[model samples]
Target: MNDLVLTGDRPTGPLHLGHYFGSLANRVRLQERFPMYVLIADYQVITDRDVPGEIRRHTTELLLDYLAVGIDPAKVTIFQHSAIPELNQLLLPFLSLVSVAELRRNPTVKDEIAHSSQSAVSGLMFTYPVHQAADILFCKGTLVPVGRDQLPHVEVTRLVARRFNERYGEVFPLPEALLGEQPLLRGLDGGKMSKSRGNAIPLSATEDETAALIRRAVTDPDRVITYDEERRPGVAGLLTLAGLCLGRSPGELAEEIGDGGAATLKRVTTEAVNEFLRPIRKRRAELGAGDVRRILAEGNARARERAVRTLEEVRVAMGF
Candidate 1:
């Protein structure tokens, strides 16, 4: 069996520092070791009924971010999810293996519904986990890199794969979730780093913008810079951000900062984050629009070839 890995992000916005440490950095490394498929999940964006125009723009922006982060198109297949019809085709059978009650019980899906603005959950949103299963199984992915929150989705994927195999012979590999060691980063306001919240520092943001965002980050009123997450979540969050950028533990940095206080912590974090993002910002600026388009074209073609083979196998196995 070939070593295949599949992972992706919704093109809801530009990638951010939270994304880098969360998953993008891992993709850069994994591409070197496995035949990796990094998808631009355009269809998944519609789970919330997002604007089509915005999704198109963000998709290109995301592709640029992937390139800026050293996800070599030459090594990794980076495709737009909507471009692969086979993935959508596979979703129907996978849905049959799961019930509405099971989908409703999914913790991840429940959290998303609670967070979304819709009064009634869209059928698309409710069934997206099965859609995600199709995304993974259509590629015969053996490994999926994700954060803790996404573990439920991976579980659903495994269940769908197992059920399909038991019913129609073995046609898919049971993909395993590869969780990252780094903790998820919080937004400037101390909540989850989200684009809609206006707290995220986009990977494509200018150096000045990044520093400005850090300056506005919430911190504690305490005089001493301590890393107590419960009492000083804001200050601790900033320290966590700084630590990720500076290669030090948050507690260690908090102690090193000593009496410099919250103001000092913010200043140090701004400097470290800017210095770290300098090269990425510079490289992103240097990429022309034409370069991004060409890369996507090539990647989509390569991904389609593999997806076609997998879907063909599925059809033959199930007598489609």
Candidate 2:
């Protein structure tokens, strides 16, 4: 079996700054060294959402963001989730291998449930991790790049892969979690940065939009800037963002903006963000729906070929 990578995002919204340093940048570099399959997880959106509208539009935007971020279509097989039926089919046998109690044991799921503070989480949401394993193993992914919070899901995938191979034969390779180097980028308000919170800076945002968003970033009244995250998270968050954009350290950046106060910190952050995103913005603007559709068409076809072969092998191994 060919070793590959499987990584993607739910098409709930456009890609954001947190996504950039968290996983996107790493994926751009990984594609060059490995056969990477980027999935636009449109199907995963409905797992927690009440009404998953605008998914097609969001999926197209996601493709555009992938291209804009230098994830070359030629090297990365970027495919949408629903387009490949065989992938989800793997969930049948995969889910049967795990129990409900085991799924609840996944820490990510528990955290999400507590975060949402809702008792109405659907069955789909509960079984989401098992579905993720289908996404990974269908591509024969040996490496899954994820943040610390996502490690449990990958662990679940590893468990399912191991169990399947032990019972049905050695048909799948256990995928490893390639943890991200960057710490979690917090919201401008020093809280969670999510679409629902309206605190994240999307990659598709215009230069003016970026500046406006940064202008409102929460920062303290301290005149002398210093990188003390525990005491001053708001200021440090902006510093962290600017540092990532300019490839500098947050402490060094804090020194540069010394005594400039929150205004100067936000200004520097705005400039750094705009300057870094200029090229990516240009690329995102140049891309169109036509470009997105054609890329997905070809990618989905290629992905189908891969999924079909994997499924056939799985059937033969299981005497189906």
Candidate 3:
């Protein structure tokens, strides 16, 4: 079987530092090693229905961020999820492979419910992992690169594939999780780096804007220079940010700042982050709207061709 890697981001907002440090930077390397499919999950964006305009603009903006961050159009297939109907169609049968109780137990769903803090959760939100399973299994993905929080989705995809093979003939390979080692990066306010929280530093933000965000980023309130995440989450957060951006270790940074103040750590963290983003910012600006549009158009064509082929197989298998 061919080694295929599937990964993507929800186009709910501009790609941010959390995305960059968490997984996007890793994709630059993985794309060279595996047959990578970078999906722009626009359909998933509608899970929260209030942000239609944000989703539309972000879909295009995400394409720009991918281009700016060295996601080569020639090396990887970049596709919008909504543009591929076959995958969505697969969600119907695939949904039956797993139980509603199983879905409720999924950590991802639980986290989303808690994050939204809403009593009314949409069916789309509840069933998203099954849809994601369809997305991966439809493409016959063998390797899924994701952070630890996403491990549950990969687990569910594996379960769905196993069940589908047992119910029908063997139709899909169980995909494995390629988990990252770094701790989950947090937003400026010490929460997760989320656009909804308004604490994210957009991958497309200017150097000045990025610096400004870092300045406001929550740091150790104790005003001490130590890097104790348990005692000083804010300073520890900055250390994590710097380490992730500079490709250094947080422990090393902690030792380096023997007697420095929180201001020093902040300054150093800001500089490290800005320096890291300099190239991407320049490329993001250089990637004009017309160029981004053309890339997505080509990506859409390539994606549809593959989706059509996969749907043909599904139809034949199920006697559709």
Best by TM-score: 2
TM-score of 3: 0.91
Q: Order the candidate numbers by TM-score, best to worst.
A: 2, 1, 3
In the range 79-161, model 2's lDDT, one tens digit per residue, is 99999999878889999899999998899988877665234888887889999999999988999998888999999999999
lDDT of each: 0.87, 0.89, 0.83
Count clashing residue pairs in model 3: 3
Query: Candidate 3, 186: how far from true, in Å?
Result: 3.3
TM-score attained by model 1 = 0.94
What is the lDDT, from 0 to 100, of the residue 67 in candidate 1? 88
Q: Where in model 1 is the C-alpha error above 4 Å?
A: 50-53
Off by over 4 Å in 3: 117-119, 220-224, 254-258
> Which runs in model 2 stand beyond 4 Å of their true positions?
117-119
For model 1, residues 121-201, the per-residue Cα lDDT tens digits are 689987889999988887789899887889999999999999989999998889999887857688999987878788888
